[model samples]
Target: MNYLELYILAAFFVTTYGNFLDVSVWEDNPEECGRTRFENTTLDVADYSKARVGQFPWVAMIGSIHPDNQILFFCGGSLISKSYVISEAQCGRLGQLVRLGSIKAEDTEEEKDCDECGECALPPQDIKVRKQIFGNDCSLNSVQRIIILELEKPAEYNDFVRPICIPTDAFCHTSRIRQRALTPGFGHIFSTLVGVTERKEKFDDMRYVNSAIVTQEECNAIYPDLLKDGEFCVDYPKGVNHSCVGDTGGPLVEYLKVKGVARAFLIGVAKINPLICEAEDTAPIVYSSVCNYSEWISNQIVSSIEAERKQGRRLFAV
Candidate 1:
């Protein structure tokens, strides 16, 4: 092909696929990696009030707008990048908007000033679903949704807002296993003296549980079918709290020590296991393994940008 033809093809490729790697702000100096939290504690509890403010910066609430114009929380999600959220496919069903910088459930109500933090509250940022679920692979069935939120403007990062790293399989294999990972979301506490009874109403105060990674054999035993590719389970044995309803699509995060400092990375996406979650004895809480789909997650982010660029070109051509 002549130089002119080659130029045209090159231009087409660039216009069709915007350069995402060059534009993403996810890359930062290693020293400045995880700086969104205020406090770090060794306590093991499920209470949101005890949680350090801005502890889970990537934790997001997926919301839906009611007819009366009020927003309601339906499921939880994790901000993997500035523009992408990784969540369970089921939670993306009514997903319309995503709110960030909230440590409490009631913080979603309105943007208010935090006297202690000395900064005004951040409002919920709107987002769009960029990619659908992968094809009928039962093994990867748990990884259901990827939403690309529309940011009105670039979000200002402070101590309360930051993105979490999506870990590759290599990272998990080398450093993630056997480490305690934290899963945070809002849900009800159930008590079962006679039967499963709701001891407390689901509140907005974020609740969390620290889960330990379990072997594939232990995870598969909970279900009749064998564990599929890209899936694993975490132990939430008796007396150990597990994720329940209202926390779907939330992240299973771990702080991997790098150079003696722990940096947080999203390791799993919480999945439903009604029997295990309720009983809290034998069965384990299943998670859609993030390490298995690390490549797919990267592709979706880039591909989504490409799709958007192509659409823009079409509109201009028209």
Candidate 2:
């Protein structure tokens, strides 16, 4: 089905069966963020590989509906809270519809595609955007190319949909150089052909790449004058893996143990790179650092609630 059709179908399910859906507005709890029951056990494979169902609970598919009613999924994002998502500023105006809890991008049914192991995820949640907040210095050349999206309504957290943790002060201060990170998205599997008339094939199921954070010095060596204060670089140990087209605005996360529990922490927002998935050129992907904007994010969330309250809208804790 087309994008508009899929959205209409999703709305029908919520409207007709709203009472039976396992829906609840999650409280804003740092400890609870980034905790997921599903474990991705396919780490031994190549860095570029298909993600298992429910592997990345915070990954969001950002799509825009055209005048013709066709939907184009141009970017990926991460759910930072029940009411907010973090993505690249470039994706801010492109689309507002956010799809969560599905590994297969084409699955329009309320319930996502089940795996061979009989593992099934909860129905995908399609949320509309209420507001878009761009970073103060967001621009193509700027390192702070981040955008925050406020959902029309709070999302209900479940086994298939959850939030990833923003970096705490403690986590940011520690050395992160050479630390491994994962970036999941429903990006195109192949590089765009310059003169080809046919459309490029995209990943039907979302895929993730395993890469490591490189030191600023290492990043500068490749792209001098590109590495800035609010950005970091990531590169796969094996040169074949790289973020492709449609992967922009997705989260670059690190799995770390916090208080004796392993959680995925948001480290960066995938920056838009002109050179993507080129086999010959293995340039590290640059991402806007999330740690640098933790304070800004907090302030925006607070300000949003205050603004809503002034307008007399009943706001719940997120």
Candidate 3:
């Protein structure tokens, strides 16, 4: 092997290693060591309306093993069916509870304005969870009729963060479908102050991170085996906005309804392209087709609503 041949071999190895890492491994901070390891490119994130990086309103649905409910399974879910906090079963280990809604999503002077789900100028809505019932295995939760997380507002359904329609059919085909609508509790955001400063000091610039919907085939190539048969993935755009530790349980929403919950939060599986690993860019993400499990979700919704009615009639003494 001459020097030139050796150089060619070295270049080939380098390119192969980079590509291999691209499809499977990522460096959260390759500059750091331990936290830096192979991660799924398809993870989601959570936010605090603009108040903080990954704080309140992004609840972590914690649970317990012996029914005492201790382990914290922090998935990001919204107040949509505040009466029934929806999330993934595998992430459900038992006695789960919601967390921090203290922070408000009001906008800072920099970002100017947004919507109810955004940086609304007014004080954001807040509530304490009276009770929450997600399936430990949709079967058992159904048997015991305590499904509703019990909220007092159907009025919450005006425009921002209302319950999206659940697909009537649960088992839909993912084989050839190319596009989908996805939503997440996570948003790639910069403080409104930052936006203002950037505008004032530098050229006009806008940067935010939110989840996207990608094709199954493209996602499959990058995420060849991370999913377990029926499961899929979703992500905000890349960079500071992609779904991170807090956006679990949040909806992978589409149209104006709940299509899927962000399971990537607790599941901890993603594999992003190294080139786009930390850029303020967007990439269509994937989601577990909840449409495939429509019947199961419907049963939960039906059972919960019926019980709510019966309890109401009983209170009225009808």
Q: What is the C-alpha lDDT of each candidate?
A: 0.56, 0.70, 0.32
Error of 3 at 250 (Å): 1.7
Candidate 1 per-residue lDDT, tens place, 1-318, comes to 345433443354345334213212222212333445543332364332324457667777776677887776666787754555667665565667677777666444555524244544465455544344342342334333333343323344556667776664457567445667776776522111122223234554665666778877666676648466777777643454334633667778776554545667777877654444456334566777776666565554445445667788322110
Worst 10 residues of 3 by lDDT: 27-36
Q: By TM-score, how accurate is candidate 3?
A: 0.43
Using lDDT, rank the candidates from best to worst.
2, 1, 3
- Ranked by TM-score, top first: 2, 1, 3
In model 3, which regions exceed 4 Å deviation? 1-74, 79-82, 90-122, 136-155, 158-161, 170-176, 180-184, 187-212, 215-221, 235-246, 256-286, 305-318
Clashing pairs in 1: 89-144, 105-204, 127-149, 127-150, 128-149
**Candidate 2, residue 102: lDDT:** 82
Q: Which ten residues in a row have the lowest lDDT in candidate 2?
A: 190-199
Per-residue CA lDDT of candidate 2, range 86-161, in tens?
Answer: 9887777666688888887664665546654678887788888889987676555555678899998888888888
In candidate 1, which residue ranges exceed 4 Å CA deviation? 1-34, 39-49, 106-154, 175-177, 188-201, 237-246, 259-261, 274-283, 313-318
- Tens digits of per-residue lDDT for model 3 on 136-248? 44552232211234333322322222232333322143232423323433221211112101111111111123344445566677667644444555544334333331232
Model 1: weakest 10-residue lDDT segment is: 188-197
lDDT of 2 at 309: 72
**lDDT: which is higher, 1 or 2?**
2
